[model samples]
Target chain A: MARVQLENVTKRYDDVTAVEDVSMEIEDGEFVTFVGPSGCGKSTTMETVAGLTKPTEGRVYIGDDDVTTLAPKDRGVAMVFQNIALFPHMDVYDNISFGLRLRTFSDDEIRKRVEQAAEIVQLEGMLDRMPDEMSGGQRQRVAIARAIVRNPDVFLMDEPLANLDAKLRVHMRTELQRLHRELETTIIYVTHDQAEAMTMSDRIAILDGGELQQIAPPLTCYNEPTNRFVAGFIGSPSMNFLEGELIEGGLRTENFDVELDPGAVPGVGVGDDVTLGVRPEDVHLAEHADSLADHTAHIEARTDVLEPMGDEVFVYLLLAEEVQGSMEEDPASSPNQLLMSVTPDTEIHEDQAVDVVLDRSKVHLFETATGDALVHGLTDRSDQESGPTATEAE
Target chain B: MSDRHRTDGGETRTDVLTESHEAELDRGPFQRWVDDSIKNPQKVYRAMFYVAAIFFLVTTLFPFYWLLMVALTPEGQLQDIIFTPNGFNPGAFVEVFQTIPFHWYVFNSFVIATASTIVVLIIGSLAGYAFGRLEFPGKVPLLLLVLVISFFPPAAFFIPLNDLFNTSFFFLEPITGDGTLYNTPGAMVLPLSAIFMPLAIFILTTFYSQIPEGLEDAARVEGTTRLGALFRVIIPLSAPGVATAGVLTFIAVYNEFFFSFLMTDGQPESWAPLLEGIIAYQGQYEVLYHLMAAASIIGVIPVAILVIVAQEKIVSGLTAGALKE
Candidate 1:
């Protein structure tokens, strides 16, 4: 097992910079995931770490050995490509045994290690089968087996589970978690799926536009994202942002006013514009006026589309002016519109006006022009005041 | 009662007519036959195809059959409209051999053709691989030059080549000595090699380009040197293409006659022009019909077998991954 560090590593292809000044540290025996959208340089970062591509500038160190100049084989790393690049000419056993044979291992040793890897991936029965004979899931398992047989210090996988079906991907995710626990090797996995990053990573590194946005544990990242990009990228149905102003009484919108913590609004005077961020689950339906009074803002909106998701009902609401136009015209943007996750037992109908109370405690504030979060002292906040933990959100 | 009965009678008559029409449709012999033919048309088409193919084959082979008949006819029995030979004599074969060293001539031709083919394959594959895979300065221009050279007529280089071979080295004439490649097999092999090299290189470069770049990457990651990867991975995967190049080169070398005819001076003892003597010019007097036919037939066999053995490679090489599964 090795700890990998990229010291301001950069990669350039002629004039286009594929990865720009990316720097992160992956601890020994840790499962770190590099997550981003397509063309965001996540795969480039992983390949740079594996020494498949030389960084144009900066250095890469794995366990104190500078590997920036080393070849992929000499770097002591194994990679599983997204295509599951199993040698089609070789059978399952031979594919697993290839690296071992390259290193000149004894036949008996190669056989033992190949079998052990096959057993780990539950591919014992497929040893004699060629790559073409195997299913996509089985081919991926063989690829994993090929990586495992080497017993390298670091295992790099480039979207290895992408080719499998949904159910198979989930099953393999659990298997991978178990494998990590048993083998205790440093794994740097690259994927575009945020859920995979959250579920599988010991620490997640989110990248965008060839730049490292944030690197932290899944819970820490979800609760206290460093910037606007991280906050919008991590959550499902993402955090909703409403452009408004910080006025004399509290956070003020054209239709409603919200109460804010004085400390949360520090250095902010009247007429300062900001965007208020809130998750759908945090907004509650206020049934009575007494309950509505506790909230800084209560606005009545008509439910245009109700999506019952078993545990919660996602009511798509429309404000007064927006309701007159059919729900088709900007359905999500009713003038006083809000999405509320309520008890499934609560009966709600389409075109019926209902009051929604926005929770001030869970709402986030961001700079209107820069899109950066307004609050700076999240490190000092207690666990309860932070956004929902990763587990709770999952 | 009268209206109901009348309607019932009319309905029964229409039903009877409809039933008869439906039955006629079911029992239509011509329609049934057409449907069956549509379902499995290969059976009928296959027989007709074979008959047509046989007719074409006979039409093409008739001239050769007639030539063989003339060759086998006795010296005195040379006449038109002979259904069958009165008797077959071995005199023509003996006279053909007695007139010249026929076996030596055959050996010389084999040596020249075989040597030319071997040289072409080696030089061509290397040039082809370089052109196909490597990035170097002037690659595009060089490729265009090669293609242009391939279009140059082979006979255009004969006089200059003959002069160069016959002349002594300008400065080293006293020590290295003057020697002429004229009247030697080198004359034929060397010039023919040059003539066929461009075509060989062109065919091979196209073939080599179709191999996947991923295999090379994998090999590099597995600690293979560039040369090692080329030999171990690329060459094995591209066996069919290489075989195709070899087959084409062999065929071209074997059939080449112009350079051999000009350089070897119609000498039966030399490697090339010997086949001409045995087939067309026997001591500048007469054509040995039987021996010439036999030798021509024998000469084509090796090429035919080579094509048959390497048919898969040639086909795949020419197509170059178009129909890859």
Candidate 2:
């Protein structure tokens, strides 16, 4: 297994910079996902590491060797694509043995390895069946078997489970994790689905506008995002933002005035414009405010929408809509009203008036103009007052 | 729709069948048929489809029947040829094999059509792969130019081609150093391959493009070079397109009469394609219509057999795109 490093990697196509100065270090045998929206350079960064695309600048290192100029075949890496690209003319056995045959392995070794890979993917007794004779999941297993037989140092999967049906995608996601654990090979996966990234990765590197936004564990990125974007992107239903100007107490927007103890947060905050960020799960209803008593800020609001998600309910609370309408409207301010998430059993309904509490220990504050997190650990939830671990906040 | 009287599981099975029968009895015979048609339109559609198909089939096969009737008629009895043949003279087809070294011309057509078809498939697939997959400086304009050339009338190139064959270097000419490639089987093969290449390339490029772009990339990442991936994956997947191109090129080359007639200099003994040889039956003094019809029928037998053998290859069951399901 090999550790991969990209130092100041940048890729450009004509005038457009697809990947801009992305530098990440992935430990050996670790599963790291480069997750982002489409066109966010996650695939481009993976391609650069795979030697499919040369970086316009900087170097790519795999196990201490420079692979920036080498062909993809010489990199000792195997890739699985979103569309399971099994050879249509070849049967399962032939497809799996393709890499071994290409490397010119002996007949005995090829057969042994093919059987081993088939057993790993649970594809026994189907070796002689052509690709068209099998189901979609079976074809993808052959694709995985093809990669498995190669026994490469690193595996690069670009949305390998994107084409599967929803139920099958989840099943294969768990299967991939188990495979990685058993094989102990370094895997660099790229996906646009944040949920997959969060569930399957040891560490996730979130990208936006061709820039690496944050690189941390999924929970770390979720609880403490480095900036406004990471906070909103990492969590389900996304984190909510209450935009306002920083004042003597805390952040003062059109309708709500959140009070913050001065000694609780470092750096001068008066007259500095800021935005209050909190996740949907952190918002508490009045009946559920028992655990949020310490420094919670309570606000009375009218519920506008209720989305029942079986396990939990997303209640969109409208607070001071007439007051928010008085200011020159901003797009980020559209979510100015809070979206409080509660357990499905909670007695919440649309158009119901209730008092919602913002968990003071779970609140985040960011610069209004720059979208950078200005004050992390403002509430000292861990009681260490350590602030965010490093410059990345998480 | 109710199963309230059901007690045991075995009785439930019989009750379900009886209920379906009662449901069927609820509608009139025509209404039941219409309801079945609504549920599955394919069976009804096939009935009307075969009727139309048979009508067109008869319109096409009637000419072959007329050819057989005239070929069996007695010599020069023009009036009775269509109405009645002299007898079931099965020996008349032997004249087509005897006249003007017909076997040699048949062999020439076979060699030229088969060789030209092989050459066309090779050149077409290579060019098709490049056109469909690769990015080059002037790919679009070059493909457009090939398409435009395919539209050009074949007869329009006779003058320049005839001069180029008879007057250019020996590379263009035969080894005899006469600078004339006339009446050589290789002469017809070259022009036929050139004439049929554009359509073959078009068909193949379309087929290759429909395949997902991920196959090559996946192969490359799995440790195969681009060209290696093409041979191992892409070319094998393009078998249907190759067969289509080969069959079409073979048929067009087989039926070619203009250039085949032009280069042979009217000497059927030295050089003639099947089409030109059929035309040779009309002599300078009197036209032998009966012999010509007999030769025409014999000439198509080889290609008809080719169709029967290659018919299944034209239907593709490729599964590359199904991986995304």
| Candidate 2 structure quality by residue, lDDT tens digits, A1-394 | 8999999999988899999999999999999999988999999999998887899998999999999999889998988888788877678898888888888789999999999999999999999998889877888888888987888989999998888899999999999999999999999999989999999999999999899999999988887788998888887787778877766545677667766643345453567777888888888986677866444557888887788989889887778645432245432345457777889888877887798877777888888787887666455533443333222232
Compose the digit string of candidate 1's lDDT tens values, residues A1-394.
9999999999998788888999888999999999988999999888888776789998999999999998777887888878777666567887788778778889999899999999999998889997878788998899889888888899888998988899999999998899999999999999998999999999999999899999999987787776677877887656666667875445666566665433446556567877666667767777633443234346766787788999888877665544354645433223356666777998789888788877554666777676667763322332333243223323
Query: In candidate 1, which residue pairs clash?
Result: none
> Which 10-residue window in model 1 chain B sums to the lowest lDDT?
B316-325
Per-residue lDDT over B1-325 for candidate 1, one digit per residue giving the tens place of the 0 to 100 score:
5566577898877777897998677557888777777898987698789999999999988766765676677654666635665468656556556656666666677778778888987788788778988778899999999889888998889889989777765564454344567677778888888888888888778866766654555555655656666675666566676787677777877777787667766666545554566555332765455667555655666778778978966665455432222
Q: Candidate 2: which stretches are off by over 4 Å?
A: A7-17, A51-61, A64-71, A260-269, A285-297, A300-315, A321-336, A342-357, A380-394, B1-51, B74-79, B134-139, B168-180, B265-271, B279-289, B316-325
Error of 1 at A208 (Å): 1.9
* Candidate 2: TM-score, chain B only: 0.80
Interface RMSD of each: 4.1, 2.7
